[model samples]
Target: MNRISARRGGASSPIFARSPAGSKRTRARIRGAALIGSLALAGAAHAELLKFETRPDGPNEAVVATVKLDGTSHDIAGTLAKPAKPAKPPSGAKALLIETQSSDDVKPLALERGLAVLTLDVAKLPDKARAPALRDVLGHLRGALKMKRVLGRAQGSDADAMTDAASAFDGLLLHDANREPAAPTRFIETWGADAYWREKPRVEFANGAPPNGRRFYLAGIAASTTATNCAAPVNARPSAPALRALFAALDEWTAKGVAPPAARAPLDADLAPAQDLKWPKIPGLPAPPEGARRVPKIDADGNEIAGLRLPDVALPVATFTGFNAQKNKKGPPCAAAAAIPFAATKLDREKNLDPRPALVERYGSRAYFVATVRVIADKLVKERLLLQQDADAYVAAARSAPF
Candidate 1:
């Protein structure tokens, strides 16, 4: 549904100087004003109809809801809960989180893990309500860009845009009945994860945007450039390689004039002409060894063991840590209350890497250990697959999520 509105301008009637033309012009103006008013009213009404609403059908079923944003007014539309399945979730199945462009992906991730998964339409946001919802994000970006130059400072412009997009996502999640109904702790954790995932792509795009030489723009471009050039050497294994690869693919796709993976348009099309440039390649690090998998591990099926590897020292530990999960009000009933950690020993002792005693000391247990892990999708996916074998494994591991 589309709504058309009129713009009001105040000016003297120059047409009055003329004769018959003046009378005709006055009639046209009146008609236009009336049309504009009518359209505006209709749009307001439609917006109200689509606002947020929640419905509950049964226990264990997902609640369906929708929220519509109107300038100062939030109207709820409909809410309904999905029914529970006959087969209870796997013993330790907690909440399942899925990222996709459609609902189809949600169902599978939830079913396979025997967990309830919530999906949101991240691409769309209520236009009228966007301002208030995104205020903090804008403020943060503005503040971050004001800092003095530092070697490791995040790029300002790209970071700001990415932050803005993330704030929009948070707004959408705020109204999502599914996310709303979840346990507060679970909801917060999931919200953070979702926001992180949503921001990654936006940040990459923001960085890839042509540089404006402004603090924020330069900050973003710098980060994006570093990720493209030094990803493998700096981060390596499990996810770094893939992260670098995905960005590289986007870079290549932009060069070829095709849509970059799941992106909306050519990478640099909207950026200023001066901002369009290729990322510089890092000088060192040998190309990926042919036919060697980075994070080779047994999959849920066990029959298939496939994973990504970067040159990162923490790759093994991070990969191991991913195999854990936490228990909460939302997931299964376990007396333990918290999930255990699965530490990675192989990567911890690498001579070239910094010694992160914190990783071992904090997460170390007689039975398991924790590796310094950064929470990202590529890592999450690999960890999720490993935990599928035993629901408890996922719960224990999730509790230890490093993010």
Candidate 2:
């Protein structure tokens, strides 16, 4: 009578079946990083506009400028682009001031909404001259390009440089920044909905530790990476749509004085010491790290309890986490998260001694699973947490998934 106990394939499997403990097909690896902090700035304002033109292969105006480092003559290139049509410098246009090199989505998505996009290669800038050089660049965009109001964008350590130069722009949209930019220069920080950095008991949340009203999640690396040492699949829930929607909100906030959605992420109560996390006893699941790191508390099903639950998180066929354990088991957790799919049915899970529910128990049929994704995605769109186009794409992907 326990006939559903034999077959196995996970979400990563070709048809989303069950993954047995011994199956190599279930493993996904990963590495991770990001944050914001403060540092002193140095150097003179040495910058010059180089060239502006419309590339034959592109539909938007191409802008090139340079900001020379203070002590050295090295110049960091900058690009300022308008929404559409081969054109010249813009006048009275709101803009997005990108700091570090970010995902390709931000520029095109913002441009699609008619907001001007300006990119600066700040990662290449020397540490000391960054703040003032950033200031000088903003002046150029405002004075020469006639940008009306501009919002700053940066991620990880580069986000800190934006804070050092925070006052130059109207607003700043940052990813994985730990500290909030001091007041008056309104800002919104994204800590990556999938995972966060915590410093044991001393710090419950290393990224946005105190939990500011303007901080939230899902403004993360456009794509997740797989590494050799990780124990399972990296938690690579598609975050492009979430990222685009967040940018749209920031654009409205900086340009038209609109308020973005309230912050949604793990609060003080949502975190626990690494060892204290309530992980399910899935057979062959890697052991968690034992150290000063803090992680999000999980539900009975072993998925995170807070933050933006994307389709993979909301309508889950597999379990996911922010930090994955290293295969060596002696070192700290691998920089990235992990993904492990559920067994095919209750009988299979029981036979395998897997505590997490089987996929069949969670979604009795493919129709229900796909419908739930649509419902969750539509809600995110209404909440300004996801773009409509992205929502449609997710649904279509679900229809074709090896359900």
Candidate 3:
């Protein structure tokens, strides 16, 4: 019989005392390691497939998706309008533009240009929560689709949320009246030609470090605050054209690395340049507490200030305002601003308190108005701001408008 030696604690035996039950413990340890490894593999596999639900909405496809982040879930809703597949593979990277609100009329335009638009309602993610949620969503998108570039477009309060989440993305196009400072971010505001409210650059970067790396672009449109409501059925504003043009420019910049030129003039509210005039405070509001700021000053002509004047504004069809007082006294302090058509005739001018030059007078006649629109459209197209297809449609719309 072969002699066997076994050690237990400190003592040694020649006839091996049956190996202690610790052998079972060793086996259990091996099994635990294998279990953990399998779980990690399962998690890796699960992460490969993000879930999205598709529903049919007439000719469009509606997507409802739930993205998980930090053990929590966020719901995203969007509409998809995919064009017919091209004969050849698309040349550039497939891009995604995320709108942090309902889908706008511009989605179809993006689809026609070979981009996918996903509109997310981030109401639950307040200003503070948006950054982390956006990061997780973008991460998931990157992993699931292997997307290399993502662009963000948002409006109003949603624009604020995008500012908070700006650093993680390739680019952002913001339409915000109350915009916060961020690096590598573009701010676009629609101001009424008659409103006193103006925006100034609040944040600046040093040495191109934090807050998204020192790339900043700013542009403003002379239009009412409500002008950005491109989806509004009856009160559709001229803002849609400018917004579409901006989007086209951004798309080219992002896809082809061709940056649109910066605004040629000061786009912010630096009232001193316009005139050293002070604005009057509203009567009933309590005197602003200490450290209060004054309202932006307007120019002698009563326009808020000069900005990146879009054709509808630079060329003149109507006067738009950035601010409006609520009609009802009990309502909110300010109502959404609006646009009033420039007087069409002398009689129309006589009825107004302060009438602007009528559109008919400026363009001379309906035929001239159409001709002028065509010229402006051509100029915007040359600047790479307006797509040729959109420019043609815009000209046609102007021709059909009730001048």
TM-score of each: 0.22, 0.75, 0.64
Highest lDDT scorer? 2
Model 1 scores worst on lDDT over the 10 consecutive residues at 213-222
Model 2 C-alpha lDDT per residue in residues 1-403, reported as the tens digit of each score: 0001111232121111112333332221110000011113334344322212222225433333344444353355555566763353222254555546735867777666666776667666676666666775565446434567777778766777787777777778777664566766778777653334422222334455232226664422222456557777676666566667887787777666678888776777776776677678877566664566656677787777677776667777777655566776686546666677788888988998888877778788778878989999899889998889888988888776544
Regions more than 4 Å wrong, model 2? 1-70, 85-92, 193-213, 218-224, 327-334
lDDT of 3 by residue, 101-178 (tens): 665546666766666677766677545445555654565555334466677777667766666666556777665434
Report the number of the highest-TM-score candidate.
2
lDDT of each: 0.25, 0.60, 0.50
Model 3 worst lDDT run, 10 consecutive residues: 37-46
| Shift in Å, residue 330, candidate 1 | 52
Ranking by lDDT: 2, 3, 1
Q: Model 1: residues >4 Å from true position, as ranges? A: 1-87, 91-100, 103-106, 126-307, 310-403
Assess candidate 2 and give its lDDT: 0.60
